[model samples]
Target: MKKFVALWLAATCSLALFSQGKPTTKPMYLSYGPTDGKNIIKFNLLGAAIRNYAFYGERMLSRKVSLILGCNFMPRGGVPYLENFTDDETLKTLEVGTFSFTPELRFYLASGYGGGFYIGPYYRFERFSLYQLSTTFDADEEEHTIDLDGSLKTHSGGIVLGCQWLVGSRKNIVLDWSILGIHGGISSGNFNGLTQETISPQDQEEIKEDIEDALDIPIIKSEVTVNDHSAHVKIKGPWAFIRGSFSIGYRF
Candidate 1:
């Protein structure tokens, strides 16, 4: 009876092990963000074509955390409607060039590598170079030309919330969309010498109202400082944008 009991016990243990079966690979293994690797890089297609040519890259700290960095370069070009103005020795059309840098810390809700809902704090810096803007006006049956020269720079920081979607599991394509973002920052302008006359308050108000209405938002938060030689501007209070991106990347 003892021998028979021992054999039965061994047989029961074997069957239990068989039923349990070998553990399948972790489900996260199939997921990139759910499972973590090393790095992924993407380029902003729209940004490249648009005014700012931008490129972005990401490094995974963990399955749920990552850091993002981006750089943008915009070639110097004349401002809109600049052609309407004339360029000469003292008066010339204004041109602007910009370079920007951005850094962000992102948290992924559920990761394979980097997709889904994310919220992060971002800091952005932009450098701009300004040129002269010249135009002609008629006064007293005579033509008069005016030139305005200035330089402007901007810096901003705020929270950004966005969503990412991945398609084609084997290929693993990534798409990112910034649903809504808000930021407030400061902008300043300086002129070596501005020889144009300032308009009256009524004219200023009319221009401001027209600009606000056209933009669908109130701009010109404050004319921080306006002196004979230079001026400072603030762009704050309410600012928002919807940003999106389409790019390909490698997950390792």
Candidate 2:
């Protein structure tokens, strides 16, 4: 895609410029996204298509170790529910916006300042807030509604294995890939406003059993959140990904 090409070129060029300015044994570089990954405090126009904007900075702590700090944001958009609600009232319900912070420590196995194969541990925290909704749903083909409000928080940590490439004369065009990565975390929801009809244990079991058929949205089966009073829920699960990145930036 044109976006990817631009991202790689921009990241590479930006990092190259940074690298040229300073002469130090310790390598310092800046890069950004699968989209626009700017070194300085800048916004990504391309990543905005997916409602994502990412910013990052990196410096080598030692000859073989580097630290990267990154933040990604969705300014005006929110994550969607697992399933689409059919009714007008349900459709009108609004969720909250989200942002994430990632801190990573990389141990380079290959020898280079700009490009190398590296592996490391990364920790990411994602927060979603300002969510409050009142919507109706069908239970046992009977219609009912509940009001709820809550914020969701996720804490995750994992390992990533990847390599970075340099393209420019000074190797500033950056292309990086984390061929494999896995993260596990607990997702918690906190809420207080729950108004609904009394539900029996059997009813809860039934709802859990055929959750897909009962509700308009689908959450992970393994990570189910439920309650008798107003239906408060929290889910714990694992997160995994194949991460690839491209950035054009200066290296110093």
lDDT, model 2: 0.60
lDDT of 1: 0.60
Off by over 4 Å in 2: 1-47, 78-96, 130-134, 137-147, 192-244
Error of 2 at 43 (Å): 8.1
Error of 1 at 189 (Å): 2.1
Backbone clashes counted, model 2: 22
lDDT of 2 by residue, 1-252 (tens): 999999999999999999998686643333333332223222334445556677767766666787888787776443444245454445355566768888988888887554689898999898766455554546666866665566667888988887866556544455665567677776665543454566557665554454324333344323334467555544334444334344444444
Per-residue lDDT tens digits of candidate 1, residues 1-252? 999999999999999998889675334433454345456667666665656677778886776688989887778875544446644433335677778788988887765357778887888777777665443333346644444455556678877778776556543566777666565576655444332555445433543453344335355444333333222333334333334555555554
Predicted model with the maximum TM-score: 1
Report the Cα RMSD per candidate. 7.5, 15.1
**What are the models' TM-scores?**
0.59, 0.56
